[model samples]
Target: MIATVVGVGLIGGSLAISLKEKGVANWIIGVDHSQENLAKAQELKIIDEGSTLEDALQRSQLIILAIPVDAMLKALPSILDKIQPHHVIMDVGSTKEKLLQLVAGHPKRGRFVAAHPMAGTEYSGPEAAVRNLFVQKTMVLCDVKNSDEDALELIESMVDKLNMRLVYMNAEEHDLHTAYVSHISHITSFALALTVLEKEKEQGRIFELASGGFESTVRLAKSSPDMWVPIFKHNRSNVLDVLDEHIHQLQQMRELLAQEDYDTFYKLIQKSNKIRKILK
Candidate 1:
């Protein structure tokens, strides 16, 4: 089978590599707004070739939309407009609510499947693409009931072949849960990075004094704003809810520290340690 990857960025390039490795697609064609990205993907051997969306759609059996959620919203309907009965389109966008709603009742909705692969790194572009990026990662399929059985089955099979865990959820639940688990992490990281940059005026001191914990906590700050801004915009309500709680928790900690209530501050940290069992 020939597969077309529309973004040719980190997620798309990585998926292209995995598809060929797992024998899901014998040939992979890439389509992207940037000819440079397409060329880079080809040079990296991440794609067999790069083609326009129209040409790629004509020749490919599977289309993977790995672009940002906003781009997905604009491109999806047109892609669906051109899909043949044999074609199945899947998206790996972070937020789902808006995109799902946009195509909810379209005539060719059944040909498209809504998916969010819960995997990535604090990186982008074809050079950041790595092999086995999706292995053992969760792939959330939203609103599967709206998709045709064949389309859903094909994606499920591909996910299985990719060695990923499959999860099912509605659009609302997907967006809300991801806000708590995924979106909040990036926002916090970005904020923490900004805080450090602002407080530590001596720039070189940051590099000299940064520890493993600090590095890990701020790593997501390196993520592309182009990718994250759309996610935050689409999942605005859920993100705001999580941010409210996060700010409340921070306020409690600040109050405890300011009041010199060491006992209570220690207890707060101990309570937070409950996450150890869940994570480990």
Candidate 2:
């Protein structure tokens, strides 16, 4: 298959590499708003060539949009408008509810598959693209019932060939769950990074003592605002809901610490350790 990967950044470039290496695509065409990204992707051999979306769509059998949610919202309908019956379009946006709703009633809706590959890192650009990023990661397919059978099957087979795990959910469910599992983590990391930076001004050696735990906790803060702001905007309600619960937990812990309630604080830490069972 010839695949056109729109956005040509970390996710798109990485997927393009994997597709060719794993034999999912015979040729990959990269489409990006930034010509510099296209040039870099070509130099890295992440894409076979770079072209405008319109021209690439004409020759590609599969189209994968790995752009931010905001751009995906703007582009999906038009791409669907131009899609041929043989074309299958998939999106790897973080939040799904709004994007899925926008295209819900489109005449060519069946040609698109809503997907979020639960993978990435605190990086961006074509240079950050790495092969096998999706390997063993979860690929969530949202609202598959609305997609044409062949379209859904094509994405499923591609996910399998990439050695990813498959998950199914409706749009709303996907957004809500991801807000809890993914969005909240980034927001917390951003907040923690701010907290430390603010403190570092007063204590210049603050970061000198930073360790693995602190590094891992604040790593997502380095993620691109270009990508996450739109996610928080689109998944606002779900993110706010999770933030409320997260704040409540933080308050409970704070109250315990302030009152010197070591017993309850101990219990709170013990309770939080339950996450290790699930994660490990």
Candidate 3:
């Protein structure tokens, strides 16, 4: 298969690498607004060539949109406008509801598949791309009923080639669940990082005192704003809902600590540890 990756950033570059390595895509043509990113992806051998979206669309059988949510919203309709029946388009955006809605009535909607590979690091750019990043990860397909069976199957086959697990959900359900699981975590990490930075006047002291847990908790704060801001923008209500609950939980803990209620505080932590059952 010939695949054209639209972003050439972390997700796109990594997908390009995996598809080539696993023999799923015989050649990868990259499309990105950033010339430097395109050049870097080529230099890293993440893509065989770089071209405009129009040119890549004409040449490739599969088009992967790994751009930010905002860009995807703007680009999706036009891309759908250009797709032929033989071409399959897929997106790896973090949020889905708004995107799916935007392209809902498009004539070529059947040619598009909404997919989110639930795997990534707190990194971006072509250099951040890693092989096998999606291996064993969950790939959520939102609103598959709206997609053509052949388009859906092509993406499912690609997911299989990448050694990923498949999950199906409607766009609304997918957005809501991601807000709870993924979006909230990044927001919490960013907030935690800010709290530590505000309290620790000296950066050197933070580096000296940081442990593995602290490092891991703050890692998502290092993620690019270019990617996350649009996600928060598109999924504003869901994120705000989760954030409100999170703040309430923090306040509850603070009040317990203030009252010197050690027993209750301990119980709260024990309750939190129940996440182990789900995660493990």
Candidate 4:
């Protein structure tokens, strides 16, 4: 099988490499608007060949759009014209609600499968991509009912090649769970960064605190703002709703601290500590 992957950034580059490694694609063609990325992808052997969108689309039977949500919306209409009924198209964008709505009425909507593989790193560009990025990850297939039989089968086959688990949900449920699990984690990370940076600046006496928990929680703060800003914007209502509840919980914790409530604080820590067992 020949596959064309657009927006050869981290996700696209990673996918191209994995497909080649798994022997899922006989020829993996990369398409990116950036000349630098194309050069890097070629140098790194992430793709068999790099070409313009038109050239790649015309030759390949499978298309993968790993671009940002906004860019995905802009590029999708042009995609519709080139995509054939037998060809399967998939995206690895973070948010799904808006993308689903935008393409819902397209006559060839079934040819496109909405996919979000819950895998990534705090890095970008073709150079940042690594093999096995999607290995054993949960790859969510949204609104599978809306995708064509061939498209769905092809998409699932690719996931199997990557050793990914297939999970299904509608776009609405995807957004809701993503907001609670994924989106809120970003907010927590950003707030933690702000908290640390502000403390390092204003509190000179607080420098002695060195802990693993702090390092672990703040690691995700290093993520790219370019990727996050749009996600927060597109999933604003859900993200903000979860964030409000999170802040409320923090404020409640602060009140307990102010009152010298050790019992309440211990219970609070124990309740949150249960997450370790839940995660395990």
What value does the lDDT take at residue 114 in candidate 3?
A: 96
lDDT by residue (tens digit), candidate 4, 86-195: 77889999999999999899999999999999998878898889999999899999999999988899889989989999999999899989998788998898888898
Q: Write the per-residue lDDT of candidate 3 for residues 91-116, one digit (tens) a residue.
A: 99999999998888999999999999
The segments of candidate 2 whose C-alpha lies over 4 angstroms from its true place after superposition are: 202-204
Candidate 1: which pairs clash? none
Supply the TM-score for candidate 3.
Answer: 0.99
Q: What lDDT does model 3 reach?
A: 0.95
User: Which stretches in model 3 have alpha-carbon errors above 4 Å?
Assistant: none
Deviation from native of the Cα of residue 193 in model 4, angstroms: 1.2
- Number of the top candidate by lDDT? 1
